[model samples]
Target: MTDDIDPDEELMLAAEYALGLLAPEEAAAFEQLMARDADFREEYEAWAENLADLTDDIAPVTPPPALLNQIRAAAFGTAAVAAPQPEEVEPPATAPVFETATAQGRGLLQRLGLLPAVGGGLLAALVALWVIDATIGPSLALPTATATLVSEDESLVVEIAYTDDGEWLEFNRRTGRAPEGQDLQLWLINGDRAPISLGVLPAAQTGQLRVPEDYRQLLHGGNCAISVEPLGGSPTGAPTGEVVAIAPIVWET
Candidate 1:
């Protein structure tokens, strides 16, 4: 697909995506094209993470006991299922009774943590090789789910990702590959009333920003947006830009 993106259009889309606010079809379309349009992805990621962070600030009130139980039931189900059994483990053999000189070495070996470690090392290597071959060979593409973030101008890209998991949305203002003086900021919009401030995303070249486990609900449902604001961001809570990219979080199969 043609990437034909303007900084402003992409930014609004990024916010919607980060807010977990996009309709399923819109999100899928973005994800399918993001690789070719990474600028879009990057901005979206930052916005989503930013908003996801704001929701993080509000404490998730504990659902009452009954509600908690109900949630668990809905999540886990009441169907009868067989329990998983533990794998049988063989016990180690008793140490050898050897000559005096050999006995001393064996005694030392037992004292050190080497005997079991050697066997474990071989087992670990085998597992590692198996995992690498299985996971690496398939060439699994980035997730169909995509996230997009934006700068205040709504065009300068910041970060993006392909998962609802907050890892992709964390890139803050490290450096701007865009025009001069434009840095990325993050925000959470209710899409109902207005947007709320989360905080500056982490700088570039850093790892994923942790999703505040606390405000997870916002990531699941809300119209999130990224706007082009000042270098620092809005002094007020409302958005202040051309809205470069946006993505709305919606339920998808």
Candidate 2:
């Protein structure tokens, strides 16, 4: 593809390359183009950064031995051989003087009747601290809300949750289908404020939307609406098409 590609197409290509969905030949061609075009390279790097951030929370895992061997064989034309086990070795014996000193120290504490008290106090303090921590510590939780948008005989379920990063909305269920050459757009309607566009819904029955931080507060006890708009989205910064569904956001306790 030429460097003067459409923005959406360029973004899609960058996403595909970052996700490793591109074929080897396509990846090679993309890499060549990226090397030649600074802007293309920047776009690809941005996609890579975003992909990395999205997956940063996932824990790393080691492959099973059988799977690893199969991968090795596929890549190198030979299965990986297991390394020989190392022989167990005995640890060095402790010096008698160190043991004697430790025993003397323990005997001195016990004779003074302080060892038991100290140990018990330390254990109790640790347990109390643990209890306090468990009871009062801030938990990693998000505030969530749900709403059901209904119009006539059709109904759709939507959920909103506030996270540290931003607010997210999930279309758990959608009943209406957008007409051909048109798309369904989700809008956030705060009390008397102008409707804020979330984004276009995918064709699937369920999808997610990220609400910008500035618009997150609007989702609390507000209303969510769906409207039919152009393929891309509403062009007039407002819904021009017919509103299909409207639901009140119910905050979760």
How does each model score on lDDT?
Answer: 0.41, 0.53
**What is the lDDT for 137 in model 1?**
22
Query: Per-residue CA lDDT of candidate 1, range 105-155, in tens?
Result: 111112221211112322343234223322222133432222333333333
> Residue 101, candidate 2: how far off, in angstroms?
64
- lDDT at residue 174 of model 1 (Cα atoms): 34
Which stretches in model 1 have alpha-carbon errors above 4 Å? 1-145, 149-179, 203-206, 210-214, 250-253
Candidate 2 structure, TM-score to reference = 0.41
TM-score of 1: 0.33
The clash count of every prediction, one per candidate, is: 49, 0
TM-score to true structure, per model: 0.33, 0.41
The candidate that wins on lDDT is: 2
Clashing pairs for model 2 are none
Worst-scoring 10-residue span by lDDT in model 2: 100-109
